[model samples]
Target: MTAISESGPSGFPPGYFLITSTATGRVLDVGGQAIDDGAELILWPSKEVSLVQSRRSPEADNQVFFVDDSGALCSRSSGHAIDIDHDRLVLRHRKPASFAHPFPKFSYHQELGEINVKFDGDPTRNMYILTSVPLRKPKSFIDDASQFLTTNIRTPFASLFGGVDTNSTPEQMTSAGVDLAEDEVLEEERGEEGEIDDSPDEKREIHMLTIPHQRPWNLAEKAKLRRRFEIIPLRTASKRTTGITV
Candidate 1:
């Protein structure tokens, strides 16, 4: 349960990252390094180079874009951002006047660690999903941001993801065809070792300190996090943009 760092004022970590599509397995790319205003953004098949770029340590912004506070994806080289034009995502000069028309606000899906980009003043219409290539996908949706941030993204799902068990050994699952539910597999193993009825007189070592040490909770720190999530707006907006509709 490693804690995730709070992304900056822009609601995203400032660095170079490859935005990918979960449905298409494609990466969001700028065409021809276009710097003209209104240059269109398109999806391209992810390449080995794209993977390398996605995992690159935050360096020079060659293929990288900076997410600004207004939800604009700013090109590092051009100093422009991907602005919304009608329904199309394009590169444009981000200015105060065009803010209402082009810039998109974003929402985070806690379950999958996916970012949903939607138009400002509108929430439902034309929502686009954004993901990173190197990041680990989350297991299940958690309501609390603090809890979600602390959760392990690689945790195995009991019902979803084709029945993967993080605790199960490869040999054990290989014998079961890896199709059975994790509990069922564990039950069979438990059956082999019969349940024992322990006597009160029997002495067993109790590691009391281990439990508390495993989950270190500080009241002041938890209250601080709770307050932060409250201001952060975890819930999605109810309405979408004016022109777009479901």
Candidate 2:
């Protein structure tokens, strides 16, 4: 298969063009004309392109895409680059050149009519972008857990123990002016009032009851936990089509 780089043998420069799948005869479309990030790319019916006019047609912005110099395929309407999100294609804000993201570069096969997307230029992990069906929302166990911890657990836990340094040891708390002797004072008061129950049953009950000790939750550690996702190509059929240009 003859591979075509971003600058194709057809001498087509990086400009807005309708990317149509030869297999499905459907063009790459931003689902629902969504302008938000993480919008899925789907295959939709191709719109008519005016060959004579060099300008874009109205209401066709969602269907037209262009390859940037970085080889990122970006939608004309949203200006977001197409990237792999949980193995599905999604739109994301273009990261600054200095920042490195897992976005791959796009190339084409001249004879096969296939778009070749490679991550880190690895041929073993080459992915094809082709699908007529709408993509389902991606789910991640780690993301859900992170969200639950951040929203339901962490917030309330922090508020309940406001100003209490959970990270501090008992000695650190004492050094920080915490009245550790208050418990001893209460015990002394109970002893003076003869309120100490030295009954065998009471002692046995106390011995049986055990509180499991858990490590103090560190809010700083949450910052280090990153949300991980993978890009998986949708392989719906074997008869892949060469993506057409409009």
Candidate 3:
């Protein structure tokens, strides 16, 4: 499912809050914000990245954490509580040994509308707070389409860059996370499906215009893309691949 956002994808439900690092200036983002079990939680830049590329930022369902009745901080995306393994943060299903492990507790600063989390039995270590970050709002189809074209493997190229769906009504486009201008929407709707040539040459031209020629393939960029696209792996990458590929 492609995520859409108006403000940011990191928005949580009313009772939940974003956990940000005081030292890093990054919010706690589930690895790719991918809604999967055992997804690693990491500190990512406060700004919107993959899933919330648009200003109509939908909620970052993966980042939201809940304070369950058991006093354990649980993830909305994975339904697992936050845990520490060998001093590294991770998410895992509760087990018998989980009882001995420290769980997170939440505290609110009502005057500032800020929330913070503290690890069990201690108020100092591994604490995170809530903060706001600004995001770009002037959207472009190229910016988003480029990302979609590069990342979406399920949809074929011809279907993706078919030069807009003339059959779709204004409401349909909006529901599908498209934020085209009123005039553009109407014009596209009225356009004859055959009027725009979808020949091989024309499709290539349209593809070049909507999508970028090249994308960043650095480790950090790929990691972010994986999370945003929800690319699940059957098994973890081998240590050799991890060391050499990156």
Candidate 4:
């Protein structure tokens, strides 16, 4: 989908959001393809993308990040985000190649055929040729499509694009160790093995702060901690082909 801001920049040529914010909701010009600046972008006959929702909360912007020439919208200098409804729409202005890995929806058609194996001599071909190697039955079209829609076979930005620093050993430890972890009061009084740990909620806020304006939606990262519920982002590598090419 695409939308033009009646109030945002009117001279944007064509490219991805090196910087932008969307708390206000996305707007677009469609470069004048649409009748108005606020015209909504929809699921072109192709269901590969869609605009299921829209809103005009307030005129807000998020931080945007960049590295060399990787054309992707960013909420921070490191990752990405869709923190505002408006920001979602503005992303449409991006060239298809920008978010090529992340389609709003998926669609594909396939046909399976049985092989008529031949002995290479007789009039009738009854069975398929077999190999010593074991083979799995092909999944149905629906199964294949579902896999396309839901499978995330990529490492996260925290590990990619220089997000996480595995080499940076902690100069200070805070969170408690296994011995006193069972007793909350004791752990609180005596700091943990790491630096004095902050509350999870507080840490979440800190994580959000790390986002660039354009990458606001990427604020879902969970700080490295005991097994916790948080958004784990999966980023695809910039490559020509994806998994399971038919």
Best by TM-score: 2
Q: After superposition, how far is residue 46 of candidate 4 from its true place, in Å?
A: 32
Clashes of each: 4, 5, 9, 36
Q: Where is model 3 poorest over a 10-residue stretch in terms of lDDT?
A: 202-211
What digit string (tens of lDDT, one per residue) describes model 4 on residues 88-128? 22222233676534312101111111111122244433222
Candidates in order, TM-scores: namely: 0.39, 0.44, 0.32, 0.15
| Model 4 spans with C-alpha error above 4 angstroms | 1-53, 60-69, 75-246
Pick the lDDT winner: 2
lDDT of 1 at 32: 60
Between prediction 1 and prediction 2, the one with superior lDDT is: 2
* Candidate 3 C-alpha error for residue 47, in Å: 5.7
Sort all candidates by lDDT, best to worst. 2, 1, 3, 4
Model 4 weakest 10-residue run by lDDT: 106-115
How should the candidates be ordered by TM-score, best one leading?
A: 2, 1, 3, 4
Ranked by TM-score, the better of candidates 2 and 4 is: 2
Local accuracy of candidate 2 as per-residue lDDT tens digits, 8-93: 43222345566554433456778778988788777665555342224446476787776676667778788888887654667888
Model 2 weakest 10-residue run by lDDT: 202-211
lDDT of each: 0.42, 0.47, 0.41, 0.22
Return the lDDT, model 1, position 224. Answer: 20
Between candidates 3 and 4, which one is better according to TM-score? 3
